[model samples]
Target: MSAGWIYNFPFEININLKAIDDAVRAFSVKYEAFFKVITKSLGGLVNSINFVLNKIPWFVLILLVFIVIWRTSNKISKGIIFSSLLFLVGVAGLWNLMNETLSIIIASVVISLLFGFPIGILISTSNRLNKAVRPILDTMQTMPVFVYLIPALLFFGLGKPPAVIATTIYAIVPIIRLTNHGIRQINAEVVEASLAFGSTKLQSLIKVQIPQALPTIMTGVNQTLMMAMAMVVTTSMIGATGLGMEVLIGVNRIEIGRGLVSGSAVVIMAVILDRATQGLVQRSEVKTDGQ
Candidate 1:
């Protein structure tokens, strides 16, 4: 009848989470060579993207931004504004750092799309698979972002490779969820009509389903990109260099001004990406609706 006894469970059930950790670590060690190959490949990819971003003339990059935003939104003013925001990062002398961060984001998002989109499509086609995968997607999305870093670090060590891998895992859920939802939400009649018109399953899926689902899928892309951006500071903890690293360094040194500047740059980049991608989503929606 005591309050403690009433409120707390009497059973002392325990789960040996350490055993799971040990098992994973052992598996990673057993497949060390395979992991090394993956790490090397990812490292090469990150370096290549960083190199390409760095090689572009600052003005030309800005111009490219202008073009992208202008075309997507059909508004020159918004393009100019966002382009100016990007320029300020350069003016603040964080251009190279920005590129490094962008490289990681681009790599993570590309990888996420490559894997997640197809998996989403496959799951959407089958109820059994969809049920099986939904729980996994839910767990992945709800799991601590920090937790992804552990496996990544174990496999790839401390570098951009691990950062890319961790960031991809953290960001992939939105695309998969959105892709699945987009496909499933399409009108049944449309699919039936395509099949009735002598279309094979693959043809209907590619020609009709995908096009109809594209806008929602684009929303997922936007969300995934944003999530990838969110991981920048977190990924920096594992020695990934960029604006996030700058922020980390500033925090360690207790340099308020340095942290603030880098943090602002991160915000600016996020805003630019969000707006640009949202613009594309809006255009896609318009096109879909018009059709």
Candidate 2:
């Protein structure tokens, strides 16, 4: 009976295959055009940014980072922590690679915010859309990071763009989810008071909700940055040149030291970003409380 059922299942399988084939054929042109536009535009934008940023001397960049640390955290201890990571990256001779990695991470994080935050806002405004987007966010968040590489490579063809594409997809989810969560969690009384005070919908959202929710949203951004860093390493498999590539090379050549060094560099980067962003979020919360 089992064998007979298996034989009959081939018809159902064929039907499913045919449906998939038809769908792919129907959307192939649309997908191709979309991919071309995104990959080309994003690739060009990142390359241009890299060109300008790369021209700045490393010393200047280091000084700027330290300045940012001091201004944001307002503490010598935090500045030292930030400086130490930069120093290690320089000493590892992975400075350039780390910069490239940073470039990609920055690009992805910026784009993710540009795109994710709006979707989050939109979802927050509509229960129907929120319901619709929830499952998609679940899938994006839950899917294994490596699984995205296949379709990403298929569409963007293995380079910084593809890696960025993959990284953006993986990293964007946290921001979207958190933004929605934050907006939804805004104090109802505050919202009501704003509405009572002749606040327009936009004004209420901007003044009351967003200001109150900024800390939570920033937390989401922090998570997005961490996830982006992780994806950058995975993306190196597809010709993303960075510390990730170093780790990939080490693995391929069975050089444990190379992998360990690159892996540590990535960890350092993650820690620095996480701490900096967390500090910023904390500062924002404090400011909001003071107000």
Give the best candidate by TM-score.
1
Q: What are the per-residue Cα lDDT tens digits for candidate 1 across 69-142?
A: 98988899988998998999999999999999999999999999999999989999999999999889888888
Instruction: Evaluate residue 238 in candidate 2 and report its C-alpha lDDT on the 0 to 100 scale.
Output: 89
Backbone clashes, each candidate: 0, 0
Q: Global lDDT for candidate 2?
A: 0.86
Decoy 1 TM-score against native: 0.95
Model 2 TM-score, 2 decimals: 0.89
Estimate TM-scores for all models.
Answer: 0.95, 0.89
Clashing pairs in 2: none
Per-residue alpha-carbon lDDT of candidate 2 for residues 81-107, written as tens digits (9 for 90 to 100): 787778878888998888788888989
Q: Please give the lDDT score for candidate 1.
A: 0.94
The top-ranked prediction according to lDDT is: 1
Off by over 4 Å in 1: 1-4, 14-18
Clashes of 1: 0
